[model samples]
Target: MISSPPKLREGLEVIRGMDDIPLIFDPVSGHYHRITRSAEALLGYLDGTRTRDDLVAYFSENARVDQARADAFSRQLDTFLAGLERSGLLEGSEQTEQGTGASPSAGGKRFRTSMLMPRVVLTRSLPTVLEPVARVLRALPARLIVVLATLGAVTGYAFGFHTLFTGTPGLRDLAGPAFLIATGVMLLIVLAHESAHALVAQYLKVPIRGLGVALLFYFMPVAYVDRTDAYRLRGRGGRVLLAMAGVLSDGWFCGVVGLVALNSSGLVQHTAAFLLGMQMFLLIVNLNPLMPSDGYTAVEAAAGLTNMRGRAFTLLRHTIRRQPLPEHLARFGTGARRWHVTYALASVAYGCFLAYAMFHTIPLSVDLALSVVGR
Candidate 1:
């Protein structure tokens, strides 16, 4: 047995969820790999150990894997080891067989760091001043936030939306310095929007990995904060708050700007109308539950289920095929299965809306861009 700790690639981020699912992020590949608890324990043994046989023997003897599955794993342990090596997580491998170590139950789920758009960090991860902000926020009652957010939402729907769309700004409003100032303000608002998520997450004691802008689809730049650790928070409400933070921030900002725009006159009114419309549009977009946006995360929290959409889709497939649910799918409780089924139906309708929105928005964005440049 060449029992030496295998070389682990650097710059990989390891995170553990409250469910103990291990998420390994490869910065170089911009991919996140989620491995099961058994896989995690096996990988833990790879600390500078170069031999696969020793780890296999150790796993066979002392691993906390399910007893029913132990004999099966023992039979195919070598293939599992090989799968780990093929993932490029380890620097070197003594085994050459490909797709090794990929147990059906323990296999990794790979996500390319995003869902709708490709993300490349405009700035690398760094420390944030959000800790102090979180501290201040934590000192306040959670009830206060909920009340304020509810009130703001009610107010926005009642009056803010009307002001946002009633007085339409012409393309001329977006032609010159007026548009530039609005863009700058919107950027600042976006930064604040992402920071709100970070702050709420910090208040919940979730580690903030970093915040940066990413060029969404290689065109428009979007700001985002790494609040992936929010999953580690045990309280479902905490996770929901973290997910809803940015949406609440947008709502509040839009309400404030809309009220101000309504009270003022002349160019201030026109420009503010334009800004408020854009922000309101963004707020609605972020709150779309069918997308992988804040609304989706909040729904997941409410349902106390991670990967709700995936499970929902799986349930749909099984129902269509008239087959027994897979063992992994059986892990979901009765209530969770019901929720997944409901979400699945809503998702199909929302997905169709999203498709139409994307197709229609592209031409509008091009025309808007040309109008700004052409003028």
Candidate 2:
């Protein structure tokens, strides 16, 4: 969310007789100006259907500005609108036509305008097949996680887990193609996860809002489904499936890659190993249930929490109140209470790790591999 725009600098000339063009009047200091043509196009979008938050997002994506900049612009726009109202120039209807009375027409509805983007929540609603998937997830015996972990270990070993030492030559050779493939494959896996969520939501007759790259964390973009409307849904189980869909998709990918790793050879072996390792990383990291990742959403849904952050805070607040009171609360408290702390710390660590990987590890590793392969 962004604050309202600072009042425009004093004495800025108000462009009069530009009612056809979207214009703003700042009565606080008696200044007015025509909104840019692009801004006019944006104001034309005030259909009373799209939320201000959505408009802010449209600006952010279409304008290619960072969220903060977009938000600031939104606030500025709001100030402009407020100014128009103060000048007795606004008709309450966002649309301005020649000679339309500044007073709202009987049919005109006042718009609640502001430049605020709703927090992008990471929850999605489920479809008909979600129940089956949930059943699979619930019945995923401990043996499955162990088996998956062991498979991951095997693939990790194959993909140069031992390259921490005597440098696997083939592993080094796998870097470029591996980088390209791994990145592409990981993207595909994410797409599949999003598709599962969306298709299931569609199956259940939920309107899919839209899909786009979400900044899941700083420097990490993941596809997100806007399933907040699902909160208004009926059954708890369906909601749970929506939340768990992505992680289940990750597990499914891990299973498939694990099977391939057990059967392939040469470059296929390398590819399989890379994919298996990648899936394992996603499964483990994403399933941590700490941050706003897929697993966290699952945990939130399962715990009957309104939101992950809210759940964490409630648990923490209760824990603080119950100090020296009960064993159960303390024991279960970490899972709930410590969640926000864990998420914050983990995010910081993950960010640092990413920075290191990009600046130090990736360059050194890729350069060495390219050098070796070139040799």
Candidate 3:
């Protein structure tokens, strides 16, 4: 056995999560590890002063186990420490020495792109630059302003809906320039939507590392802001807010565009109306709970569950196969099991519905694209 005790790396922050779960955040790698209470206590003992034998003795005394059990525990402890070292949680791990892990900016801030989801970084210091705006948004006056804007947006939507469905312009009138202009404006709205998430993260003291644009799922072009530091937030409320901020911004923009369409005429009205429709469509898409959208993120945060979709699907698969629950899931309480099963059923049903909708909507979308380009 090694003579030296393992030392946890510096700059690691341990925070208590929901249900008093211990969450360790590594700032260098931007990774969070959820550990059990026993593991957390073990981490405290790894202060570099105590040797491996000392830790084994400590565990033996505290757990009140015999020599055989203590020996087994020492082997388990070695395995655990090895895993931690590989994860860069240890002071002298290969990852720490090589400066490698999930952190893309460890070398330098450059464009990190992938064919699956290509993205370009627009800024890396958004928190410092947007500090003034974040401050204003967190103030009481900003809340009042938001309230007023919401009211106006609702009024605009009401009138705009009536005008649009009744005796307003047709799609042909919105063809060519109007449609192109509205599409450009909608892209800007997407930027604003992502900015809202970053702003809220900054307000909650989460670091905003990078802000830019990306093709989500390699097809849907969208703005993206790096709010990965949100895992450090201890409160569910902050996490939910950070997730829903973009959706709220989308709704607000939809309302504003509706209001503009309601009061305008000719080309301007046509553009606004088209923009409103686009925003509303995207808002619905983002609110889909079956997908990894803002709505899904909010639900996961509120439930205090990580990777809910994956877990739910796994549980569903096991149930369908009539297999026993996996070891990890078998440890879940009755409430958690119920939640996983229920969410799995709902997600499957919603996914089927979406597939059906897409089958019918594809032709319509193609025609719409053709019409917009005046084909």
TM-score for every candidate vs. truth? Answer: 0.64, 0.47, 0.76
lDDT digits (tens) for residues 1-375 of candidate 1:
223556567665676754555766555443455567767766666677446656555665776777666767755555544455666777664322112111111122221234334454433223356677767777888899778876886676556677766644554554344455677788888888887887787777765565665543344456777665565666677788888888877777777777867787666676677678678778776887766678888887877666666668779779778889965577779887888788777877776775677788787667655666774
Q: Which model is ahead, 1 or 3, in terms of lDDT?
A: 3
Q: Write the per-residue lDDT of candidate 3 for residues 1-375, one digit (tens) a residue.
A: 345678888888887764466877776666566677878878888888888888888879988999899989988787667767767788777654221122244223455544234777777877887788878767756456556645655565455455556545776566556677888898888888888888888877786678877765455566778765676677887788789878767766766676677777887888887887776677677878876679888888898876667667668788789999755566778898888889888866766676677678788667767776668
Residue by residue across 88-159, what tens digits does model 2's lDDT show? 444342323212112112122232111111224333333433556544545556446446644654454444
Ranking by lDDT: 3, 1, 2
Q: What C-alpha lDDT does candidate 1 achieve relative to the native structure?
A: 0.64
User: In angstroms, how far off is 290's CA in candidate 1?
Assistant: 4.2
Off by over 4 Å in 2: 1-175, 310-360, 368-375
At residue 278, candidate 1 shows an lDDT of 74
Q: What is the lDDT of residue 253 in candidate 3?
A: 70
The residue-level lDDT of candidate 1 at 182 comes to 72
Ranking by TM-score: 3, 1, 2
